[model samples]
Every structure is written in structure tokens, then in C-alpha cells.
Target: MNIFSRRARLGNAWAVNVRLRIAQGKIATIASAAEPQAGDVVVDTLLPALANLHSHSFQRAMAGMTEYRAQDRESFWTWRTLMYRFLDHLSPDHIAAIAALTFMEMQKAGYAAVGEFHYVHHQPGGQAYDNPAELSLQIIQAAALTGIGLTHLPVLYTYGGLQAQPLAGGQLRFGNSVDAFCDIVSLSEKAMAALPADTCIGIAPHSLRATSESDLRQALDLHAGMPVHMHIAEQTKEVEEVAAMRGARPVEWVLGQCEVNEQWCLIHATHMTESETAALAKSGAVAGLCPITEANLGDGIFNGASYVAHGGTFGIGSDS
Candidate 1:
């Protein structure tokens, strides 16, 4: 058992001489405005822990590697090309080590949990491993070792771009059929069963560009009742391409085609019109914003003022 006395925030007010009783690694009870015992540990301040709702932990190694002038006109697409090259050589051991170090740093920074949007599933040559969940289990092991809560989102990345284009270049490793994707999710769920009680397994359709409407529906059905996440409308080019192909913006298409609600998180809804923004806000989905990554990639600013005014929910992420 653990006991501590500190000045703690209770909802909108602060309470002094608050005592917390921790048992079985959880807070068993809390007492407000109470005197401390002789053996109590006193602290001057306390704060609630934060959750990083989006992360690609393996990308931490490539943080400063792409800061130089690679092209005459550097952009998100250019940076992505560099990232693809970087991941082309990362072994499972490398992924695990990087993820463990990243999760440890997050814990030190007061993060209680993380949502990992994992996509790399195959080997360097785009061959499936003997076990489909091999790479996913590596990430799960990293989370278990670091004592951080996990929400593992196994991504379904079938195509390279709009119109169901074939996977090319570094995108080869993330490709899988819808049936194969379901098997991976099932195996990943079993692999995560030994983890802490709070660990979650979810579905991620990389984006509208990477998945078709049918594939998206199948993935959602495969992991029904779980939190669903996707990258949406992060770039102007993406918005334009989606509009050109589907005759609708990305957000508009998703909101109309799917039943997005509280269990959904649309990451980087950065490029949206006023109507799209208001419509998504009414859908009760969380906006997964990553300001640091957005600024680094030169993605446009999210309409936070309008979104929050419409009673939209939001959560921050380290989308690296």
C-alpha cells in the first residue's frame, strides 16, 4: 500500500491536505482536507497524467534526420519519401528498441498511456512473417516492458493512393488483403491478451487514399465496438485529390459514407471547410491533433476555435 498527502486538484477546485491510498497499483481511496498520518509522504503538488493518443514510436529515430534541404521545394510528400527509406531497413529488434525508449521517455514526461498507429507488418521484401502479428507483438512487448498503457491500432494499408493503385516503393511492407488483415487483428488481440488490463486493440485504415470504402467497412466490422482511427484531410493536395476522384472532400465523404461517432478519432482534420468542420463536430468524433508534427510537416493549422465552439471533443498526439 502507498499513501501520500499533497495539494491536489479536485475537479474545478484545489483541496489541501488530500490523502491518497494506493493499493494493488491503483488508487484505492482518496480523502480531502484530511490530516496526514505520521508515516505519510507529503508532496507540494500533484497533477493528473496525460495520454498521447497518437504515436508512431519507431519514427522517433528519424526525428532530426530530415531537417536538411533534401529537395528544392521540400514538403510532406518529400519527408514521407525519406521516412519510407528509413523504415526500409529497420528490423524488428530495431523497432522494439526504439519503441521501448520512446515509451520510457513518454513515461518520464508524465504520459500514462499511448495510442500507437502501427503499419509496418511485413519484412523488408514485403514478405509476411511466419506469424502475421510478429511486428505487432514487438510493439506490445515494448509497451509491457515500459509499464505504459497501450492502444494498438493495426493499420490496414492496401493501396498506395486513390483509385486502388498498386502499392509501390516503400509502401510494399504495409499491404495486406482484407481477410489477411482480419487474421492479423485476431492474432494481435491474442498476443495482447497477456498485457495489462487496460491494453486495447483497434483498427486503423491508413487513409482514404490507402483504403477503399469496402475495405474500410470490413475493417470496422472486424473490430466492432473498438475505437477507430484514421488520417484525414491533412494536406491540401490530399483534399484536392479526394475531391477530384470522389466529387467530395475527404471529411465530407467519410462523414457521409460512414457512421462516425464518439468511438472514432479522425487525426489531423487540418484542411476542412466551415461546413465540413461543423458537420464533423456534430458527429461526436474526437479530433486527434498533433501540433508539433503538423508544424514540422508544414500542414495547415486546425480550426480549433470553431471546432471547440461546436462542442467537439479533441485529444492531443505526438504523431511522429
Candidate 2:
């Protein structure tokens, strides 16, 4: 028996005689019936770890080195070109090695789980790999190796924008049709099922620009009932184009068209109208924010104060 009584929680007060019974790597029982013995270890406090709701684990390596300049008006678009150059060189093994290093740091920082928004699927030339989901599996392997929870959200990138343009050279690996994306998602799900119950697969449509209405509907139907994620309103040019093409803003368009519920995470809803902001806050979906990356990319300040006041739920990410 162990006496573990305290009016406070999680570093608020000390714990005494908090003997733990472990069953299959889980706590089976906590006995607080008696005092601590002489050799008993004393713990100050304990709490369940938090989750990083979004990440591109491989890009963690590129965090601080992207601020160089070549000419005037160096914007996010110019920075993206540099990112393409960075991504062009990574193979599955290289990505796995990088991810393992990053995840170890995340564990030490107290993030027990990471939701990876993955998109690099094929080779640089957009050719199918021997293992279509090879890169994704590598990330999963890294997460397992580092002892952090993984929610693998594979991204679906189709066209470049509302113009239905072809993907540029840097975007080849992220390109996927509705059929190909479904196949990869299925394969990822089967692989994720082999992990602990806490590890699972989620779906991601890269953004409104990347997928047509038909493609979006197809993916939604295919991955129905799964946690879904998407990038939205991260840049003003994107907002302008989306508004011009669809006559509705990105977040507004998505909320009007699809089911925006708790199972969805709208990444980077940085630009919003008052109505859109209020609606999103009430929508029960997680608003994925990357404040550090946002500042680096000049993505503008998100309405954090208003969103919180409206009862919005959000989680941090390292979007790279």
C-alpha cells in the first residue's frame, strides 16, 4: 500500500508512497494506503504529455537556415523555392534518419505524440516507388524507434492551383491522384494498425488549390470517419486567388462545402473574416498553428486572442 494524497496536481504538490503497478507497459494500479518506505523513490508531480498536432519532421533540420537573400522583395514564395531545393535531395532512409533525430528532441521536450503531415510519396520525377508508401513507413519507423506516439497524416496534392496547373519539378514527389492517394492511405492504415493503439493514420488534402471539388469529394468519401487535415489561408496571395476563383475565402469555402468537425484540423487559418473566425471557433475542429514558422515565413499574426475568446481549440505544429 502507498499513501499518495494531495490537493494539488502535476507539480503543484509532492507525492508520497506513490507505488505503481505496471501491466503491459501501462499503469495497472496506484496504491496510496500507506507511507513511503526508506528506499522508496519520491516524485514531485506527473501529468500526461501533450501532442504536437502538426509537423514536417524532416524539415525540422531546416528551421533557422532559410533567411538568406538574393534580391529585393524576398517573400515566402522565394523561400519556398529554396525549400524545394532542400527537399529534392532526401531519400526515405535520409528522411528517416533526420526524423529520428528530431523526434528524440521532441520527446525530451515533453511532446508524447506528433501528428506528421506527410506528402513526399514518390520519387523526384513523380514516378511510383517500389514501395509506394516507403517514405511514410520510414517516418513511422523513426517514431517507433524514438518512443513517441505517431499519427501519420498522408497529404494528397493534385493540381498546383485553381488554374489546374501542372506541378513544378520540386512538387513531383507530393503529387497524387484520387486513386493513387487512396491506395497509399490504405497501405498506411494497414501499417499503422501494427503499431500500438495510440498510433494511427489520418488523411490530409494539401489545400483547396491542390485539389478540385471532385477530387476533394472523392478523398472525403474514401477516408470518411478518419481525422482529416488541410492547409488554409496561410498567405495573402493564396487568399486573393481563392477569393477570386471561388468568390469565397478559403476557410469559408471549406466550411460551406465540407463537414468541418472535430475530426478535422484546419492548418494555418491565418486570414479570416469576423464571421469565418467565429464560425471556425464554434466548428469544433482543431486549428493547427505554427507561431514560430509563421513568424519566420512572414505569414502574419493569427487572431489568437479573438479565437480563444470565442472558445476555439488549437494545437501547435512545426510546419517547416
Candidate 3:
């Protein structure tokens, strides 16, 4: 396919009458300052598509449902309570439909790919479906339908809190033993085979508050050479909880424990100290920022200027 743009951003500079040749599913060649050719798909402006580094597609369905304040002080925790209630009524089919719409919207908004941090597994009552990866397969199918490059991240969520609390209510659907979670990842891998070669699977430990140190280690060891994602320091309450139990803040503790590198993407590293920000910036891992969701939930602003000044890498995501 040939694409010609009257004005196009090529790398860091904009060029007039730029032409692009797409072969298979990738841009094969770029000819800047070129004339329009026959049968060229012409456009006014063109730019590179982005990748949504973190998302929970299922929550896209709950877009307007959680906007209003239902408590004395509306917060991320209060919003989470409503989210859990909302997910308790969703089935695999509902997940697939919602994911399809979400992926479609992402594409329409110039996102060529998404890293779906999917954690909702099993039925509402916490029973394993006939197919353990039923929800994973549904997400894969939705990506296939939308033709979005999917980095399917199956999240390992074991506990309810930082202190290894038992799972209850909506948390049950996300709970799985380390072995069971590994099996689900394997099954999800097989299901992803039907999609494009770029459609791949990664693992997420949910968060330090949701999984134990041992389980996080096991999960990390299981997926070598693949992307590893985790939620860290999204809320002050979560930071306090993790610090009280682990003796360090979420980002600080994970940096101390894990060999964080380019493959790791920490979502919502919102609350970080000067030392933590500097350490994370030097760690070579990507900070996944979800500004809209953070603002909606009243999560604090990320230390973007300082992190960028330290040469840290970051990406945006529609986390909701």
C-alpha cells in the first residue's frame, strides 16, 4: 500500500509531500519530499501511531458508571469498590464485546497496538471455567476482530491486600495460585497462536500489594525475555500499606527486589520520592503513565520533569 501525505511528520521533522510504502503489515520504505504517485492513498497529515502501554479493556464498559461520587470522599479506593461490583456482573462474553469496542476506539484514536493488562479471570463466583483461559481467549478474539497488535498480559493476582489477605467478593475472580496462573499463561499462549505473529503474551504480577514476594519471583522466572508489567505506587493508601508491611515504598521495594530493566513496565508509579524517582530513571524500565485515569481517581501527578531530566523512558496508557 502506498500512502502520500501533503504534510507528514517523519521522525523529528515534518516534510512536505511525503510518501510511505507499507508491505505486509509494516512500513517498508519512506520517501520524504517525494511527489504523489498513482493509486496513492492521500492524506493531509500523517504521523506514527502510538502504543497504549497499559489498559484494562474490560473497564472500558464502566466509563461513565463510576464518574459520580458515591461516598463522603470519592477516591481510587471508592472507585475500585464500584469497579469490583461492576465486574461481578460481567461474563466472558461481556469482556469480549467490551474489549472489541475498546480496541476499535484505540485504533480510531491512532493507537496501532495495546498492552492489555488483563486480570479478570474465572467466573464471578471464583470457579474455574471449563477452559481456564476462557477470558484470555476472549481478549485474543477481540484483538483479532479489531486487528490491533496485542501484548496479552495475564496478571497473577493472588491476595486482596499487602498483608496476604484472603480474596473475597470480586477479588475471587482474579485470584489464582502461582501454578494455576502459570497454566493459564500457557493456555493463553496457545490461544494467541491464531492471531498475528506480533500478537504475543506477557505476564503481570498485578501489584506488590496483590501478590507476595515469592509469587512475584516465580512469576518473573516463568517468563524470560518477555515483557513484565506491574502496578506500583498508584495510590497513597497502597504506598502506606506496602511500606508498613514491606518496610519500603512500592517502587523502592520493587527496585530493591527485582532486576528491573528495559523489559519491565511499571504502571502508575505516581507516588515516588526523589531517590525512588532517580533510581527508577536509571533502572532502564518504562514508567507507564495513565494521566486521565490518575486525574479521575485523584492519584497524584507523576514526577515527569525530574524523571525526564534523568533520561527516563515513559509511555501513556488509558488505564481505565
Candidate 4:
């Protein structure tokens, strides 16, 4: 029995007449009508919301907090230094508070879900918490508290490069060998059970700057059927470094070695050759473009005009 029915105009050219027969929490049916039943409640219009394809919830606290212009070269790398410093002061409770604040803003801005690229997974001093996935679990808690759909991408960051060098100082808390990292990833899945069961768990390799061949392979293999997101070719220096270490460019090398498909999201692939761009489009992965953040960080524009011309599927991200 429909309690309410009403004709509603949707967007600029669609008339949606909703007859909501609610039972529990599900929508029973929608039909064309303009009648109000006893105790009926009618609405105007409804539509599916957007998903924030990438986010660093902890970074929300540091937003507009890094505006000072240093005498030295001010770049994303420099900004990253400040980001690391900010994380040092973030306790689990503080992280959740920050996430809650940001997620509330996201919801107000029409984002229904957030794919949190959570890599900050330990104490400030790089020690594991009582639960190895404590920081990640905090993010899940924040999303639940704020009523945001959660997509947890626990990052597996190992090695400084192909050389497997020690992690840089700021990257200390992000360290985990392949085995330990995968175990923590599994733990993150357990953490998700406390959230919406529809939550998706994916793997983030951090970047080519943070992983080796064997390390990336293990993360990908353990991903089951989840999407794989990574930072690739964001900076010119990164592209040169990856090429110097391997024989090919970052994305080219990755597509050659890894099994990439629609189940992948490449974040900030801001630098690429024509071949790389064409090949990536052919792979069917969504490009996670953070236009506002890229402009803020002076990370250069993605050749979006060209990528879309090539029939690429892209989704926007608020990766603060």
C-alpha cells in the first residue's frame, strides 16, 4: 500500500512520479500519480548521488594549513613534507574527528561515498597499534558516524624504490614488508565488517616510488577481485626516476608487468606519453582526477580534454 504518490520534475527534462510504498527501509515501488493517502508523505524529486573516488581523510585537517611560501622550491613534494609533519600529531581520535568533519562536508557537497586511500596506519613513531589496522578502523568509524559509504583502500607501501631502500623519515609510519602489509590488509577487511557490509576493500600500492616489483605483485595478487589504485607518473622527477630504475616509463612498465583492467583506478597520472595515455584508456580503468587539488598543488593539468576524447571513463575525487 503506497502511503504517498506525487508527480515530480527531475533535472531539466524528466518527470518522475513517485509512489513510495515503504516497508521497513526499502522503496516498494514508483509510479505515476498525484494523490496523497492517509498519513502520506510525498517528495519532489530524487536521484543517485556521486562517489568521491579518492580521499586522504587525515589530510582534510591540513587543508589551507600549508599556504606559506618557502624560499626553496615550493612543490607537491614540499607540501608532502608538511603533510607528514601534520600526521605526526594525529591520534586515532583526532583522525576520526578530522575525517568526520571532512565527510560531513563531502555529503553536503553531494558525495554519497568516499574511497579513502588510507595509508597512515600506525603510531607517530611507526609502531603497530593494538590492532594493526587501528588507524584504518578509525577511518571506518568516522565514516559510519558521519553516514558516508566507505571504500577502504589500505595502502601497502614497502621499499623506497626498486632498490628496496629504507623508507624516508616522513614515510616511517607507512612502512610494512610484503607479508606484514598483506596481513594488515586482511585485518582491514575485518575492520570493515563493523561498517556497511557493502563496503569495498581495495589495494593501494602508494606509488612506484614506494614499491618494488615483487612487492607490487603480492599486493595485486592478494587483491582478490577488488580494484587496484596507485599513484603513477604524478611528477616529472618520478617519471624519470622510475624509467631510470626500470627500462620503460611508469605506466608503460606497469601495464607490461601487471594485470591491469577495469578493476583499477590510476590517481594523478598527470604525466604520460601518447602511447601510455592510449594504452591506459584501452585498459578500461577509471582515472581518479582531482582537478581542484591538482590546481592547488600546481601539479599541472591532466590532459583530460584528450583523455575524454579517447573514450576514457573518469570520476572526480576530492583527494585533499
TM-score leader: 1
Query: What TM-score does each of the candidates earn?
Result: 0.94, 0.90, 0.93, 0.88
Q: Score residue 292 of candidate 4 by CA lDDT.
A: 78
- What are the root-mean-square deviations of the candidates from the true structure over C-alphas? 1.9, 3.2, 2.1, 3.4
Backbone Cα, N, C clashes tallied per candidate: 0, 2, 0, 0
lDDT of 4 by residue, 28-71 (tens): 66565445667777665656578999999888888787766656
Query: Which candidate's lDDT is highest?
Result: 3
Task: Identify the runs in model 4 with alpha carbons over 4 angstroms from their true place.
Answer: 1-46
Tens digits of lDDT, candidate 1, 65-141: 88777668988998999899999999999999999999999999889999999999999868998998889999999
Q: Candidate 3, residues 227-280: lDDT per residue as tens digits?
A: 999999999988998899999999999999999999999999999999999999
Candidate 3 off by > 4 Å: 6-17, 22-29, 42-45
Candidate numbers sorted by TM-score from highest down: 1, 3, 2, 4
Candidate 2 clashing pairs, residues 3+ apart or interchain: 2-32, 2-33
Native-to-model Cα distance after best TM-score fit, residue 293 in candidate 1, in Å? 0.9
Model 4 lDDT vs. the true structure?
Answer: 0.82
